[model samples]
Target: MTIPRSSCLLLAGALAFSACNTGTEQQSSTAAADSLHHIVHRYYDDKMQLFPIDATFNGEHQYDGLLHIDISEGFRQRLDSFAGRYLQQLQGVDTSGLSSNDRISYEMLLRELNMTRESLQFHDHLMPIHQFWGLTLTLPQLGSGTSAQPFKTKEDYEKFMQRMKTFAEWADTAIANMRKGMATGYVLPEALVVKVIPQLRDLASNDTGNVFFGPLKTLPAGTDTAFASAYRHTITAYVFPAYAKLQRFLQEEYLPKARSSSGIAGVPDGKAYYNYLIRYWTTTNKTPDEIFDTGQKEVARIRGEMEQIKNSTGFKGDLAAFFQFVRSDPQFRIFKTPAQVLDSFRAIEHKIMPGVKQMYALLPKTSFEVRQTEAFRAASASAEYMQGSADGSRPGVFYVPILDAKKFSYVGMESLFLHEAIPGHHFQISLQQENDSLPRFRRFSWIGAYGEGYALYCEGLGRELGLYTNPYMYFGRLSDEIHRAIRLVVDVGMHAKGWSREQALQYMLENEPLSEDEAVAEIERYMAVPAQALSYKTGELKILELRRRYEQLQGGQFSLKDFHDELLKDGCVPLSVLEEKMKRRFE
Candidate 1:
């Protein structure tokens, strides 16, 4: 995992261009940066050709009406060709005369192209669809809500229905892909398949109040009665059956052959795939055993922090008993409605925005908002962050599933807010989008280790942003941290170690204050997607480690703003690229 710095290492003794100068030097730097910008735009546009949805999020709307993504042989070949050429183009850029920020951007661009190529090597196409993070979920997410699906015009509604027609075809491809995956031993577990069945039923529902009926409900309100009736018939006659056909195909063909194992390691080359994914997400070469052990150590340390809080509150009880108290406590449940659940997050923004100056000198131009998770999916939805439209019209959003908002507590409120809002995804991703100087590929992007790792670090700033004062709130921080730490153990444990779903649930419930229901959902999510949960804490710890190392090396010269600006100025990258960028600065 230690990439040899043979050619253009971007490592220590890599090159020391960090020198001061006068007017002409500044002008040359500016011109060099301008040239990089033009090339970066080309890189971004080329990437959009490969990932259109990402382009839509990046603010390019030419692909706006498109919903279906082609994953066949020709498309893959074209994507691979584009990525290789992009990497070549990036290498061709002259970073030897660039500033530190430009240099970081250059390395990040190379890392991203390489990661794209590496991801292409996996049979991700074989498992192109899943019940969870696959196309099925993504489609509903886009069509059901404020994503790209416009409801203001009659044409928009028709566009979406047109899009749904394509889904039946996609579903067939999905089933075929899963069948191929079964042949290759890349199937989902039977248990996970069972969980997915109910979801298919939800999608195939005939209910008029369904989220899928959103376009129907608000269909201009001005259409002629004939057209209105016709629209209803089209939905019932055409759209419904498309969903039903897919529903039946999955039940009859795909789900039955699904694997009996839970972890990614259970699939073909699962062990090696997960190891590569670990390196990809953590941006380091740490093995599952190393990550699992690190998680355990963090869990124990965080538990001690929680215990100290417990003692301060005069709660003389065991950790499990305390977890029970928090789960059942009336004091924590202040939310009376879904709006209240939403208000909890917005309130945190207002209260904490004043204190942001304490730790941050740079703030994202893209705004953040809190919304309820879309209705039909809310039951299955975990709290999530949706990045803004690349054009800046739509702000970054934190959607909390407030199915029964009255049930939510303020215990983990601050941690959730910090992780989802300012300094988390909103700040990290939006800043990258607004930064035009970095290659288009680097500015608006995702790398699990860097993105989630950076968010995890955002969670760490809860104390500094002035929210850890209340003892229970402080415990919430520890609770959130513990949940991530446990993901390390339970995620790998469930899949790689053949641990049962119940075993995973028990570990979480015993160690964290999450309700049993929440624990059940999380364990199933881990079951559905192996090694994904490890990204948060594993990535975060590495970022913190890098920062500490940078501070030590810079001594009195370290500027926190420059560190953040330099790190995030480029879009997300593999941890290795990130480390190399920092190594250049620190060394």
Candidate 2:
């Protein structure tokens, strides 16, 4: 998700909304509209700055010197306090006279606040931390070299070390929180726990090759040699040992109580949590059964397409063997280097731009780039797009993992570029950023259903965009598409139906030739973020439905260019909201 300049050119507006001069009408509306934005921005700024670790990620630097939060019941009360204020502000906002764009933003903001407050009622604050995705380990990544935190000056180095000292306190607090979670039946899956233990075990190493030692390895070249060495020594001798202690605690204490079950249904109010997440991500009231059924139908349909391709290609082998052949073929191993991997993506970009322009008039002003996945987290990563700063200070990027380029096939590379980079995330997010009327938060969000769902819909356009040409390559797209469809079944099956990791993997391999490694990683992601995989197909299905209706309604009048521009202009909205926008534009 490291936003680069190649595959994702999110050239957003360079200036913030601060630059627009005000007329009396502008000033009059500004009183309400501007106040609304100001109040929301102020809330986030105060909340994040008050919690410095959060600040560092959002490109705010004022709280770099701070770490550690008082997450006692008192802290939970404070979160409730903030929620109350925002809830009131959301209630007070008048959406009747607002522009359509602002109305959408207002609705999103309202939904987000209600959801958060409802979630907070569970005092998830009481379970403020867990080993799987804790802040203790993440803070180091935020501050050190190659991180968002600027580390050139001596003060920056000193600040990180100071941050490490406070981190120990956070780790202790994290353990305390986990203990609280255990008493409330809010433990992570035993399967997920085992995986996390190794992560801590890996980080527990003292070697310079480790990610934490990155600051030591790439200390600013101009720093005094004596100071650099001393700093490195301090981190290795002290910081590593502290992290090791936290790791030991994870190994010794937490893993024992971790549940074997995978679903939120296992935890307190877990079923409700899953329901909230479903509506939250999908932006609809889709029941688990509904999503599960859709997943099955889609998987069957996509499989039918694959079988047709297999027939045309005359692959005489059975379906599973064909999957094996497609995945394991020697010809697919053309990428021997990172440059080769990037070259494959570049080739895709060059070949597809004309086709892209043919279908869509609106394009992101941002440029895109390709980069290796950030090495630290690459092991747990998938190909993803990282959006650029809304202000266009940083270009949107596409990150491809080339950990073993030769081992990874080039079959599905182009379709992936289309999804993760241009004409997908970069296009959608950049369009949102450039919309001067959108509330700031709407421009930057993590709505898995709408955002990721729409991205998959974008991928459905691969052939028209000229990427999925060869039969093998087209099959590859089908293969990737099946994976998402399968996620709906397996995720629900594992958590809801009590299917084990081995069972899920067997089901996947029966249907597709994903390497054992790839299958396991994909399934674990489902475990980590349940029901998220369902969004793509669910959302994609709706989009395809919309397109079909439009084609039927417009007949020969249909303009693909106009269709695309109209869709992209609304950015990421709830499916229903998107439907409304499309109807207003096209009907």
Candidate 3:
């Protein structure tokens, strides 16, 4: 992300010209820097206009009433033009004269612009809705009263209603796009299509059970009855019908045409698409073959560790048998209620705070919380973190989806807390949002390799953070790591190496301690979002490599806290940019 300065001025004539040249250069640099600043701010403003949902999530309420039909051709063209325009403007900026941070911003924006332009060649809009993401799932969360969408005032309510109406129109566009995908070969796998049907059906339901109606429960006291009536009417009239139409379309039309193959390779140019995804998610040039080989080595190495743990516990069987024991044993499934599961995570937070303070000098000003994932999406949702507002009005939340507390194992709780809460996402994200020094886009930017990788790396900090004393908890930490390694194997295996869904599932079950349901969900998540699974392990390895390199180079002077702070200080960036930035700063 850094731009190297121009080399030394050479000859007598050049030296004679240096004085006037220096003044001219100074003026040019100032102008270029000013232009770059304008482009950066202008791009963010335009981006917020196009992606209003993101704006709302980032605490920009001005865009709350807008919802773009992102799947539509018109929207896609507008997005392409937006990227192209900003990219052209950026090319005019002189990077050689910019500050280090401005150079980073320039490079980040350039990468984003090129990636967006390149990605437009793919037909991503054709298959708009997926079980894991897309507006179908996202809109419900926004309307649920607990998410980013505000409902504190009448204006908030009206804004959401506008969004709801637009969403109905958006559904029709999605249906049309999906039909176009069906005609082409870009349809979802049948397994994923089935999962989406039920989610839509739940949203489409007319009863009070519909999540879109959730806002009504928390209306301010003495609110006008007509406003409440209008809210319910909007859900029933616009939202329900939209979900119903999408459900019917998916069930009757899309499902019948859905591909049976689990991998994106079944679609036209799918391999190329997956290659783009690998570059996009990992932010690296490593090929699928390289990643697959890394996964194999990691899996073998972690399995050996698991075996040692199994034998230490005097388990009467091999690693596979011990995995079963962990999954089924009553000791692991100790939580009887959702509250107990949440409490366990909170307790882990308390246990790790002293270590968290010691391990890092920097911390977020924003508060953090542990909450249950909503019931409507809990079945398919993974445990996740939602960043708090930049203004710190709302606390960042670590959502644990507890479908059955009896089946919820305590083994991974410590690692999970470290990954999703305190030092993982909440710290990385909140600090970025709070740092007024960064440009708006860089503060909110998401480079999956850096973000997810940092979180996965946090999982390895269990021992350093005063937990993982128990063999099972340590095993859980290893299980999580191996799970990510398994992703490196199976994600590339399925998407790139022509492995079947069954083959991937079997590989997961044999390698990790995931339950049948958990295994299926994980595998399908990889299937739905190609190459995304690679981010965690790919990112974690790079970070760990950087830490080791710095430790060895600095020797006695190496400080883990200082290293952690420096690494996270810029928030998330491409792995290459991160390496360059760290090398320049530390080495």
Candidate 4:
């Protein structure tokens, strides 16, 4: 993500406001702007205190030692109160004379507060541990020393020790919460629970190669021998035991009670929950049926494109056969080792840079990298970008899962890199994090419709970026896009329309070039986290529509660079807010 000089001027104007006002009026406007900024910053500061682990990720190191059991009833009550308090404070701010950027911040915060308060009604706490997300997955990454938690100092190590101790308590609370969920019919799906069991069991291992020992392996030079011993002791005594306890609870107690139904709709008030999730994840009022229909149309349109590519390649059979050939073809499976797989993605990054530099006047200051996903979670993980620290200590990482390099398909590599690495998540997220003019909350805020949508939209830039020249690579781009489109259909279908896991898996396999393993991982991802899979396509379509509207409006005057800068300059925003902002700028 790059900000053009014009955007810098816009930000300047926003901060200083118009110079035409009389001195007295200008002072009043300044006061109101100051007040609004205070409110939003205070709101963000309080939120960081409430969610300290997130604060750590955002590079606020002061709260690194703190770990809140967020699913606990007491914690939820505090969170609800925090939102209510902010909403009340925000209502007092006068916005009539505020800058456009300040107004967008106000609107974003207001919606966040309301949504947070409203979402508390759901029993999400009852089933806090899920296969796709939760502390169960996140804590290991943090403790790995390769992640956000700093291990450069003795104090840093001590802080993490405290976090490890608190995590044990968090796991106990999670167990209690899950038991309550079991009593209330709010437990996880059996499929997800089974996946989680092994993860916990693996974490419980006291083996020297355990991920929890990662920090001890890479301890800074001149570190005290005694502290290192204590760290190992903590992992052995507290961390391993904590995971073991959690594993036993899931395996012995919770697994039998896990719901057989695949969707969130299987739980109490499940339909209403899914509907709320639709709004939360997509940031839209779109009904599940609406999204499902959009998925159908998009799938058909992309399939037609796939057919053309198939014919261009002179394939003898139908689209399904082409899919099979692409999936199993040795030509597509070019990597024999994980390093080769990674190098291919790096090559895609290098290949696209010249065109990317030409198309965008600005680029992220943050460094980026491509890395292998940790082996423990690779089996279930999807390729994703982890944002770099605001201070630039960590580079934004694109983690690819390569369970078997021999089976790794190059077909989607170009598109995948375009989406998850260079100009997709890396650009969108890094730009948001780097923009200093926006309020901190807005800078770090994630509206899936805006963020993921922008990333998905970037995939279409593949051809222009000079990497999708090969027919198979172009087909790969389509495959990635259609994968998201398929998500729209299957995520909504299973969660809202009562489609089974098998049906969802079948839908994915029939519609895309994914293997059975790929299809299963994707379908089950939707099952574990309902409506989340809907974000990529939903956001992508809205972004694409906005671009077309602006292109048509501006005609020859339209600068793709300007459009991109404007889209990213304000950072992640709700689609509605993004549309309003774009219209105000270009219309």
In terms of lDDT, the best-performing candidate is 3
lDDT tens per residue, model 4, 1-587:
89999999998887665553466677887998898888888888898999998899899899999999898999999999999998998888778878899899889899999999988999988988877777988999999999999999889999999999999899899999999999999998898888888988998998877888999987888998998999999888888999999999999999999988888899999999999989988989999899999999999999999999999998999999999999998998777999999898898888889889877777999999999999878988999999999888899999999999998988888888888988889988888899999889987788887788888999999888877789999999999999999999999888888889999888899989999988988888889888888888988888889899989988999998888889889998888888899999898
1-587 per-residue lDDT for model 3 (tens digits): 54344433345557879888999999998998899999999999999999999999999999999999888899989999999999889878888898878888998999999999899999988889888987998999999999999999888999999999999999999999988899998899999999999999988998877788888999977789998999899888999999999999999999999998989999998999999999999999999999999999999999999999999999998788999999888988788999999998989888889988998998899999999999999999999999999999888999999988888999998898889887899999999999889999988889999999999999999899889999999999999999999999999999999998899999999999998889999999999999999999999999999999999999999999999988998888999999999998888
Backbone clash pairs for candidate 4 read 1-427
Each candidate: what lDDT? Answer: 0.75, 0.74, 0.92, 0.89
Error of 3 at 458 (Å): 0.5
Q: For every model shown, what is its TM-score relative to the native structure? A: 0.86, 0.87, 0.96, 0.95
* Model 3 ranges off by over 4 Å: 1-20
Error of 4 at 176 (Å): 0.5
Best by TM-score: 3
- Rank order (by TM-score, best first): 3, 4, 2, 1
Clash counts for the predictions, in order: 6, 13, 0, 1
Evaluate model 1: give its lDDT.
0.75
**TM-score, candidate number 2:** 0.87
Residue 555, model 1: Cα distance from true site in angstroms: 7.0
Model 1, 1-587: lDDT tens digits are 66776644565443444433355577776777777777777877866766655655566655655655566656777778888887776655556578766776666667666777787777767766555576576666666646754566667665556666666666667667777887888777776676676666776788876557665566686777776676566556655666676667667876777776667777767777777777766677788888889989999999888888999999977988998898888998887898877877888898888777655677887777898887767776788888886567888899888867767888888998898877788888888778776566666667787888889898888877788889899898889899999999998787667787778888898899988778877888877766778889978888899889889888899877778777776678777777777777668
Per-residue alpha-carbon lDDT of candidate 2 for residues 284-391, written as tens digits (9 for 90 to 100): 898888877877887899889999999989889888889898878898888678888887787888888898888878777766777787665567678877666555
The residue pairs that clash in candidate 3, if any, are none
As a whole number from 0 to 100, the lDDT of residue 57 in candidate 3 is 93
